[model samples]
Target: MTPAARVSAAIALLDDILQGAPAEKALTVWARNNRYAGSGDRAAIRDQVYSALRRLRSAAWAGGAGDAPTGRALMLGLLRQEGEDVDAIFTDARFAPVPLNDAERQMPGTAPEPVALDCPEWLEADLRASLGEDFVPVMTTLRDRAPITLRVNLRKSDPAHAAALLAEEGIATTPNPRAETALSVTDGARRVANSAVYRDGLVELQDAGSQALAQAVPVADDARVLDYCAGGGGKTLALAARVSAQFIAHDAIPARLRDLPDRARRAGVEVRVSDAPAQAGFDVVVADVPCSGSGAWRRQPQAKWDLTPDRLAELTALQSEILDDAARCTAPGGVLAYMTCALLDAENAAQIRAFATRHPNWTVTETRTSRPDADGDGFFLALLRAPAQTA
Candidate 1:
C-alpha cells in the first residue's frame, strides 16, 4: 500500500474505534476484510492508530475543532505532533484522503500545557500526588512504547546461554542490571516467538520489574507457596524458576489459569492450578492482585484514558480485600507478599500503610517501588510477616 493509502486506512480504523469498537477489535476486523493488505501495510496502519491514541489529547488540540474526530484529522494531528507537515501525504487525489482544508491548515497548533502532555485532566492531581514535581516528565515518557524484555528460565538455562541462542536467531538482547535473570530485547523483537531459544521456553517474555518482584519473594526449597491471584501465571512461572518450592496457583476466576498448565509445561516447570487454595498450608502467599495499571500506561494507553475516579476507589477497596484474604492463607511464621503494577500512591504506599494499620500483628519486612525510568514497567512489592508467638 502507498503511504497515503496507509494514512487513509488508519483514519478509517480510528473512526471505528471512536464509534465504540475497541482498538484491537477494530484493527482485527479491518485486517480480516482487507485481505489485499500485506503484513507491512497492516503493521504501519496499526502503528499509526496506536501512536494517535497514545497522544490523543495533543493530536486533538493540533487538529482543531471539527464536528467530531475523523481519521484524517487525527492523522494530521499526529503528523503535527511529530513536527511533520501534513501536506506531503494528505494530497487531494483518488484512493488518498482529501487534503487539509483552510480551516484545518489555519488551525492553531499550540497545545495547552496540560493537554500537550497527553494526560487526562482529572488524573493530573493523582499523578502529581504519585510522582511529585516529576509528573510531567514521567507522563511524557509514558507516551513512548515500552521495551520488550525476556526472563531467562534459570530452571532450564542461564542468561548467557539464552542470550547467545537468541543472538544466533538474529534477536538481540542485553543484560539488565535491575534483574539478574532479565534480558532487555534491544532489537529483532519481532522474531522472538520464532527464535529457537523462545520456542524451547529457555526464556519467557517478562518485564524486568516484574521479574524483580518475583525474585523478591523469599522462596525456600520444598516450601509450600501459594499464588493467591495468579492471573495468566506469569509470576507463578517466574517463581518456579527461582526456587524448588511446591508452587500452587489459584485465581478467583479459574478461567485465567486455564492456559497456565500448558505454559508451565512449556517452561518445563510444575505448577498446580486450582480455583481454591490447596489443602496443605502455605509458607508464602503472594497476592499479585489487580490494579489501575498506572505504571504501564505506555503499553496500554487507552487504559489511562478510560480510568475514572470512581473506578479507582473501587479498585482500592478490592485490593485491600484481596490482601486480607491472602494473609489468611499464610501459615504461622509465613510471609504475605502484596504486589501491584500501580504507581499511584493510593494503591501502593497508601495501601501498604493501611494494611499495616489494620493488621498490627503483621510487620512489613521490606517494601520496594520501581519507577518507569529504568528498563521495565513500574511495580510495587511489600513483604509482610506475621508476628511470632511470644514466650
Candidate 2:
C-alpha cells in the first residue's frame, strides 16, 4: 500500500477507537477484513494509529479540533507535528485524504503544558507531584515507542553469547545496563519472536526494568521462591533464569498462569505451578502487583487516557492487599520484593511506605527506581525484609 493509503487506514482505525473500540481490537479487525493489506501495510497503519494515540491531546490542539478530535483531524495534526507534506498527502490522489480546508490550513498555536505534554488533564497534578522536576522529561520520553528488550536465560546462554546467536539469526542486540542479562534489540526486532534463539529460549522478551527487578532480588542457592501474583510468569521466569532455585508461581486468577509451564520448559527451568500456594516460608516472595500502568504508556497509550481517579484508588488498595498476602508467604528474614510499573508515587514509594507502616517489624532494605529511558520503561522495586522468626 502507498504511504497515503496507510494514513487513510490509520484514520479509519482511529475513528473506530475514538468511538469506543479498543485500539488492538480495531486494528486486528481491520487487518482481518482487509486481507489484501500486507504485513508491511498492517505494521505501518498500526504505527500511525499508536503514534496518534500517544499524542492525542497535542494532535487535537494542532488540528484545531478541541473537545472532539475526529480521525481526519488527528491524522492532519500528526502529519504537521512530524513535518510531513500535509497538502500533498491530503490531495485528490486515489486513497488520499481530502484536501485540507481553509480552517485546517490556519497555523496552530502553542498548546498549554498538559496538552503539549499529552498528559491526561485529570492526572497532571498528581503526575507533577510524583515526578517533581523530571515530570516533563519523563512524560516526553513516553510519547514515543519503547525499546524492545530481551532477558537472556542464563540457564541457556550468557548476554554476549545470546547476542551472537541472535545476530546470526538477523536480530541485532546491544547489552542493556538495566540488568546483567538484558539485551536491547537494536534491529530486526520483528523477527525476534520467531527467531530460533527466542524459540529455543536463549532469550525471552521482557522489559529491561523488569529484568533488573528480578535481578535485584536476593536468592540463595537451592532456595524456594514463590512468585506471588505471578501473571503470565514473566518475572518468575526472569528470577529462575538467574539461579538454581525451586520456583513456584501462583496467581489470584489461576488462568493467567496457563502458559507458564510451557514457557518454563522452553527456558529449561523447573517451576511448580500451584493454584493456592497454601504453604508459606518462601525464601523470596515477589509481589509484582498490577497498577495503572502509567510508566509504560508508550506501549499502551490508551491507558493514559482511560485511567480514572477511582480506578487508581482501587488499584492502590489492591496493591496494599497483595503486599500483605505476599508478606505472609515470605519466610522470616526472607525478602519481600514489591514492584510496579507505575509512574505515580501512590503506586510506588507511597505503597512501599504504606507496607512498612502496616508491617512495622519488616525492614525496608533497599529501593531502586528507573525512569523510562531509551533502555527501559519506568519501574520501581522495593526490597522489604520480613522480620526474623522467634523460636
Candidate 3:
C-alpha cells in the first residue's frame, strides 16, 4: 500500500476505535478484510493508528477540531503537528484520505493544558496529583512509542554474551542502566522474537522498570517464593533468574497462566503453576496485582481512554485484598513484595500504608518508585517483612 493509503487505513481504524471497538480488534478486522495489504502495510497502518491514539487530544485540536474531532480530523492534526505536508497524505485520490478544506488547512489555536499534553481532561487532576511537576513532561513523553527493552536471563548468559548472540541475528542492543540485566533494543527491535538470543531464552522481552523492580526483590537463596498474581509470569520468571528458589505461580484465573509452563521450560526454569495458593509459609510473596496502568500509556494507549474512576476504585480494592492475602501467605519473618505498574498514589504507597495500618507488626524494608522516562516505564515496588517471632 502507498503511504497515503496507509494513512487512510489508519483513519478508518481510528474511527472504529473511537466508536468503542478495541484497537487490537479493529486492527485485526481491518487486516482480515484487506488481505491485499502486506505485512509492511499493516505495520505502517498500525503505527499510524497507535501514534494518533497516543496524542488523540493534541492531534484532534491541531486538526482544527477543537474539542470535537473525528478520526480523519485527528490524523490531519497529527500530520500538522509533525510538520508533514497535509496535502501529500490527504490527496482525495483513490484509497487516500480526503484533502483538507480551508477550515482544516487553517492552523489551530492554543488548547488547554491537558489537551495540549494529550491527556484526558477528566484524568488531569489525578495525573497531576501523582506526577506533580513532572505531569506535563511525563504525559508528553507518553505520547510517543516506548522503547523496547529485554532482560538478560543471567542463568543462561551475561549481558555481553546475550548482546553478541542478538547481534548475530542482526538485532542490536545496549545495556540499560535501570537494571544490571536490562538491555535496550537499539535496532531490529521487530526481529527480537525471531532472534536466536530470545528464542534460546538468553533474554526475555520486558520493560526496564520491571527488570529493576525484579532486581529490587530481596529473595534469599533457597527461599520459597509465591507469585500471588502471576499474570503471564513475567515477574515470577525474573525472580527465578536471581535465585535458586522453589517458585510457585498462581493467578485468580488459571487460564492466564496456561503458557507459563511452556515459557518456564523455554527459559529453563522451574515454576509450579497453580490455580490457587496450594500451601503457605513462602519466604517471599509477590502480589503484582491489577492496576489502572497509567504508567504504561505509551505502550497501551487505548487503556488510558478506557480507564474510569469506578474501574480504578475496583482495581485498588482488588490490590488491597491481594496484598492482605499475600501478606498472610508469607512465612514468619519472610518478605512480602507489593508492586504495581501504576503511578497513582492510591495504588502504590497508599496501599502499602493501608497494609501497614492493618498490620502494624509488618514493617516496610524498602520502597522503590520509578517514574516513566526514556530508559524505563513507571513502576513501584515495596518490600515489607512479616513481624518477627518473640520468644
Candidate 4:
C-alpha cells in the first residue's frame, strides 16, 4: 500500500473508533477485510491511528473542528501539527483522501493549554496536582510511543549474555540502568518474539520498572512467595528469576492466568496456579492491583480517554480491598508488596497510607516511585510488613 493509502485507512479506522468501536478491534476488522494490505501496511496504519488518539484534542483543534471531529479533520490536524504538506497526502487520486477544504486550510490558532498538552480536560487538575512541576514533561513523554524493554531471566542468562544472543538473531539491545536485568531493545523490536534469546527463555517482555519492583521485594532462598493479583504471571516470572522461591500465582479471574503454566514451563520455572487465594502464610505476597493505568498511556492511549472520575474512584476502592485481602496471605513479619502502574497519589502512596491507618500492625518498610522515562513506564511499589507476634 502507498503511504497515502495507509493514511486513508487510518482515517477510516479512527472514524470507527470514534463511533464507539475499540481501537484494536477496529484495526483487526479492517485488516481481516483488507487481505491485500501487507504486514507493513497494517503496522503503519495502526501507528497512525494510535498517534492520532494520543493527541486527540490537539489534532481536533488543529483540524478546525468544533465539538465532534471527523476522521478527515483529525488526519489533517495531525498533518498540520507535523508541518507536512497536506496536499501531498490528501490528493484527489483514487484510494487517497480528498484535498483539505477551505476551512481546514485556514490554519487554526493556538489551542487551549490542556489541548496543547494533549491531556484530558477533566484530568488536568489532578494530573497537575499529582505530578506538580513534572506533569507537563511526563505528559509530553506519554504523547509518543513507548520503548520496548525486556527483562533478562537472570536464573538462565545475564543481560550481557542475553544481548549477545539477541544480536545473533538480528535483534539489538542495550543494558538499561533502571534495573539490573533490563535491556532496552535498540533495534529489531518487531522480531523480539521470534528471537532465539526470547524463545529460549533467556529474556521476557516486561517493563523495567516492573522488573525493578520484583527485584526490590525481599526474597530469601527457598522463600514462599504468592503473587496475589497475578495477571499473565509477568511479575511472578520476574520474581522467579531473582530467587529460588516456591511461587504461587493467583488472580481473581482465574482465566487470566490460564497461560501462566505454559509461560512458566517455557521459562524453566515452577509456578503453581491457584484458583483461590493462598490459604497458608507466605514469606512475601505481591498485590499488583489494577488502577487507571495513567502512567502507561503511551501504550494504551484509549484507556486515558475511557477513564472517568467514577471509574477511578472505583479502582481506588478496589485497590484498598485487594491490599487488605493480600495482607491476610502474608505471614507475621512477612512482606506485603502493594504496587500500581498509576501515577496518581490516590492510588500509590495515599493507598499505602490508608492501609497503614486501617491496620496499625502493618508498617511500610520500603517505597519506590518511578516516573515514565526512556527506561520504563511510571510505577509505584510500597512494601509493607505484617507485625511480628508478641510472646
What's the CA error at residue 273 for candidate 2, in Å?
Answer: 1.6
Per-residue lDDT tens digits for candidate 3, residues 271-292, read 9997768566899999888998
Q: What is the lDDT of every predicted structure here?
A: 0.86, 0.91, 0.89, 0.89
Better of 1 and 3 by TM-score: 3
Estimate, for each residue in 193-241, the C-alpha lDDT of model 1 and write its tens digit.
8888887889999999999999989989878999999999999999998
User: Which is the better candidate, 2 or 4, if ranked by lDDT?
Assistant: 2
Q: For every model shown, what is its TM-score relative to the native structure?
A: 0.95, 0.97, 0.97, 0.97
The runs of at least 3 residues in candidate 2 whose Cα sits more than 4 Å from the true structure, single-residue gaps closed, are: none
In candidate 1, stretches whose alpha carbon ends up further than 4 angstroms from where it belongs are 65-70, 107-109, 278-280, 389-391
Better of 2 and 3 by lDDT: 2
Candidate 4 residue pairs in backbone clash:
none
Please write out the lDDT profile of model 4 over residues 175-198, one tens digit for every residue.
898899999999999999887888
Go through the candidates in order and give the clash count of each.
Answer: 1, 0, 0, 0
Give the poorly placed runs of model 3, Cα more than 4 Å off: none
Cα error of candidate 4 at position 148, Å: 0.3
RMSD values, in order shown: 2.1, 1.4, 1.4, 1.4
Question: For model 3, what is the error of residue 257's alpha carbon versus the real structure, in angstroms, after optimal superposition?
Answer: 1.2
The candidate maximizing lDDT is 2
User: What does candidate 3 score in Cα RMSD to the true structure?
Assistant: 1.4
